[model samples]
Target: MATATIPGPRMPRAMQTLGWTSRPLPFVERAHAAFGDVFRIKIGRDTFVVLADPADVKQVFTGDPAVYHAGEANIILLPFLGHKSVLLLDDAAHLSQRKLLLPPFHGGKMRRHVGLMREIAEREIAGWPTGVPFAVQPRMQALTLEVIMRIVFGVDEGDPRLARLRTRLTHFLETTATPREMRRLLVNGPIRAERRRIFASLLDPVDAVIAEVIADHRRRDDLADRDDVLSMLLLARHDDGSPMDDAELRDELVTLLVAGHETTATALAWAVERLTRHRAALERLTEEARAGGEEYVDAVIRETLRLRPVLPFVGRRLTQPQTIGGIAMPAGTKVAPSIHLVHRRGDLYPEPMAFRPERWLGVRTNPYTFLPFGGGVRRCLGASFAETELRAVLGVLVSQVRLAPSQPANEHVGRRVITLVPDRGGEVVATRVAPDVAMPSAA
Candidate 1:
């Protein structure tokens, strides 16, 4: 069979690289407009065949795990997340790590962290300056970072260790997410020696703190009684009955930090950004938040994620030749389901760019059509947990105060490494604060 030639922009690779790194949404929109549902585009050394059709997305998501190498497609993350990180693992290694990490984020186990999430949200919400504009993304980052530290690292409030690690990690993420650094990342890829050394300088101290926390947890007698993820992981045994070693534990912990922290924060920031611009939706969500029901709040989150998915695409590099949507792809081709484009397709969503939570009410969205988190076996293990945290945080936020856009126009999307975020950091003003909201005790 002849492989169909996938059409794309005939522009130089340098222009494609710039567009991808700095302004992905426009880049993708232009490509999809010019080349239809499937097209090829190069970023750094890899050529991604971007697919916006749900059927093609379903194929990549449900494709044979051996032939669809998600980890290889995500190799750029390895320098920060480490080789043993599940995000960087494939096949049996990926399955094993995923199994060990699953129990901690299981439904009942995850709900245990909600009260803490709300408390953190309340603490942060209380500090926002009233009647003044501020970037909510940084505040959201602080809130989510604290949640990850407390929940995943088992370091609770007032822990000096938490304070130190938080400072270091925030700076590290900020530095890496800057445009200059991101451009460098796009140019050099993940394994260049100087880049690795620079990353080592940032990651080493964070790793040191993680190592300390791991050792301290091992020596504690209350390990079995604790509900935090690190404690649960410590108690977990592999299928072979061996406990995970220090390196493995460290890698997984960092993976959770990288995977959970900014991604959830960016989602929350976008939620605030979207709600502030749409008055009726904001009013309805505020009422829902105060009255205490999951239905509408859940829809609001779904809609926010749909319109502003953190990562624009989820990729799987072909390890063996395969056909998708009638096009024969050779091995080494990265098949990326364009999450941003799929979510915006008018066929799948009417008035696709509008923020409408009502669209999700009483609606069962097809998983492939509405995957803010990537689909199938490689789907984010923390999906439920992230959603749970979003609900808790947003609930506390709306109940405590009302937000309005700082500027008349909406903020443009910005690239923070691999995640899409509000360019102006979701600038919003606290227009009103509900008086004397009752504080729930910590769980």
Candidate 2:
């Protein structure tokens, strides 16, 4: 029997899974067209009551944490993120970890990292091949990874340790993102215990390096003097005056590493992809970049994230029978707020399909309507850090080089694990480079 009372596609679950894996946006859009704002989707053994309306989304985000278990809904990520990860914790545990993790990502701290971001971005942007079509996503990935390595991991660029970990992690992440691996994950959507063990074994190499890093941090006498996230975390004390253990640090560090870099890189790739297609926005952003004004640059990033959100949905599993959108759902039913759907609603955004940065200029968008980072208490912890990275990278990129789309059409979305990435990896051709831009210095 169908677990959901809401109307949705009556297709065989296999067909629904195929559509979701291959063409998520279209699949959701088709359902929304046929079934209006709220719909049901059955994937594997779970039934997700997907919510598209902002009002309904608001209710879910603002709902009592005990009832709407975000962490329980994110259990599939447990193996990759570890059992102690803030992403895998709920209620008080999640809140306590959130408080500890909050300081380093605060607004002032993010600003301190902008110079490093611009330097890394400038160095990477300088090396982009000119007058030839090439995918920018890989380069963006490299750039963001380096940023996370330095700013979050506290690893210096030239260190042998950084090179080793970076190489291993890049391979690990890319391997997991392959179509074969993605399909395997989809088939193992429930992430059974054996599958989790397999996932953990795969992380053994990366975990070895993280263990080394944690040991190094402990040995450092100047931990309190360092501004990097890892250092602050080492020095942070719980409300009970207890320091986080090695296992907790390892889990949190890995969580930040995976979540912090990849998503920002994907967003930057999309920024280049979108800007290259929109001449006016590109020119305005470049001009703003060179003039040291960030208003338009910020707007461009806001619009890009809105249209190409890295993650399509934020999920909360019902802990008890609860009514949402006036429809009751049983315990363990997943209610997903569709970020992709709400961003495209015509009622909320005129010409939502069109890329329009000007729409955000000098406007304070309603939190529910413009939640690219998700909303309420469960909003992404790295939200500000990601935005800061984007602004710095995009600003540095546009100021240094001129980019144009290699293909006439915009790049189509492709699935990468849980993220939606550019199908062609955001292919583009750099036409011009500023002579002043310098290659990365070994310093």
lDDT of each: 0.87, 0.85
**Looking at model 1, which ten-residue stretch has the lowest summed lDDT?**
434-443
lDDT of 2: 0.85
Report the Cα lDDT for residue 146, model 2: 88
Model 2 pairs whose backbones collide: none
lDDT string, candidate 1, 1-443, tens digits = 22236888888889999998788899999999999998999886668899999999999888889999998777777778887899988999999999999999887777788888888888888888889899999999999998999998999777789888888888878787777866666677777834456577777888898899999899999988898999999999999999999999999998999899999999999999999999998888777776677798899999999999999999898899998988888887888999999999999899999999999999997889999999888999999999999999888888778788999798999887778999999998885564665323333
Candidate 1 clash figure, as a count: 0
Alpha-carbon RMSD to native, per candidate = 2.1, 2.5
In order of appearance, the predictions have TM-scores of: 0.95, 0.94
